[model samples]
Target: MNRSDATLFSGGHKGAEAEFGKLAEKFGINEVNFTFEGHDIERKVGLKILSPDELKKGDVSMDIVSARMGRNFSKVDTIRKVIQSIFHMVNSGYQVFVVGWILPDNTVKGGTGWGVELARLFNRPVFVYEQDRKAWFSWIDNTWVEVTPIISHKTFAGTGTRNLSEDAKNALEALFERSFSES
Candidate 1:
């Protein structure tokens, strides 16, 4: 049986967790690993940004991580940690997917935004589930192009759509295969 591993990137906010949970439920939990900063509580699988000593030094919970990520753009340390975690995941051959809200100002939340940017910079396959549009979009030529057929918000809210065209799925599978073979 052919299988693929994925890394999910989210904004790490209140609603974000629910979105991620819905996504995980939709796409079999075993198929993807969620990454938010250095925490992966469910799968217990992720890149380590802080050593045991660092974690032991102070309060380093998901709440703190979430707060730090909220200010990631201005916090060099937080930004660096987030970038490094993303780099590690990409380098380890995990397909990246994003799910979050796009703000009124046309900007995504910090960590999610950074993950999308990193995927673009590294030429990795990145898909974003637009909650409002109820469509899956991909970054192409510096813009978001819808990649899947339009679906209802209920469908989007339910088993998160993974029904890309056969050609698109094949292309993504090939990318994952190549990464695995290379590794």
Candidate 2:
């Protein structure tokens, strides 16, 4: 597959999202970072600033979000917009890649977890790189199964915690290497 033909969907925040954007650039892959007004992003490449109407298309009640992830999120405009934009990322990407820790409750940690939960809800192919375990896990049959995942879809998502780890960074490099090599 021509790497340039592939597009990465991400938030373009620091840590995993920014790293993913960098890797996407290194691999000659296109990237689109979704955001709304007043949102601060570390990487500015391919930013698609969603209009209020556009952002509203992905909006959902925080109560529903909390119920799905088994945790309560702060009720705030910024966080709401973040969640709404994440819905767009997952909706646009057929496959999703994330870097973060998966809690025992099966939900991923933090706001990144919302993306994972959205992926699951949308039935998108989602992979999570656990920094603590130094391993990758894929969502399969309602469970997170350890596996070696690659960038299979031409359009996929890369998201995770802002607090990235060295191993996670290396893991992403390996992922790009493994993907383009096999391609």
Candidate 3:
């Protein structure tokens, strides 16, 4: 069997979770391993099912880590933990996909979103697919950024010129073609 691991990074608190679920279906991933805090009663009971160390290791073989969101980003240690987790997953040979969802209109406060920022800082390729283009662009600023699932002509600076919706399919096709031709 041919299999490659992929990690999907998203905010744990909001729409990103739903987006992650959809992406999982698109990517054919059934269950994804993630860290869940046990602050709540239900979560605590669930956490009891496995040891903390085992949880850190992962629930199953080849199941790379997935982060939904972070509570705080001010501390360097918190950011480092996330980076370290991601680095470990990638080192395990999983392709990282950073997904960012739009924040609510009133809560557009800066600083809350860091999953994509951490991914970029670590020089990982980001696969950005969002519901609202304008809002997402406002969050990630497209001036000099390159993201996957390229859905907009304004964001498609690659070889082909096509509608944004076709960008993801086109890009994947190009990659397969290049790889096959090279071999």
For all candidates in order, the CA lDDT equals: 0.42, 0.94, 0.31
Best lDDT among the predictions, by candidate number: 2
Order of models, best lDDT first:
2, 1, 3
Residue-wise C-alpha lDDT for candidate 2, range 87-171, written one tens digit per residue: 9999999999999999999999999999999999898899999999999999899898999988877999999999999999999
Candidate 1, superposed: residue stretches over 4 Å from native: 4-72, 76-79, 103-107, 149-183
**Model 3 agreement with the true structure over 1-183: per-residue lDDT tens digits:** 111232333222223333333443454433232333431111111112223454455322121222233233334433334333333333332233332334443121223233344344445444443323521232243332334332211111011111223333433444323322323
Error of 3 at 92 (Å): 6.7
Query: Which runs in model 2 stand beyond 4 Å of their true positions?
Result: none
Better of 2 and 3 by TM-score: 2
lDDT of 1 by residue, 1-183 (tens): 112233333222233333444343444322223234445343332223445334333323444444534543444555445444444444443345555544444344555555555566568665666665655577777677777422111111111222233443333333234433333
- After superposing all C-alphas onto the true structure, candidate 1 shows an RMSD in angstroms of 10.8
Residue 124, candidate 3: alpha-carbon lDDT: 43
Where does the lowest 10-residue lDDT sum fall in candidate 1? 151-160
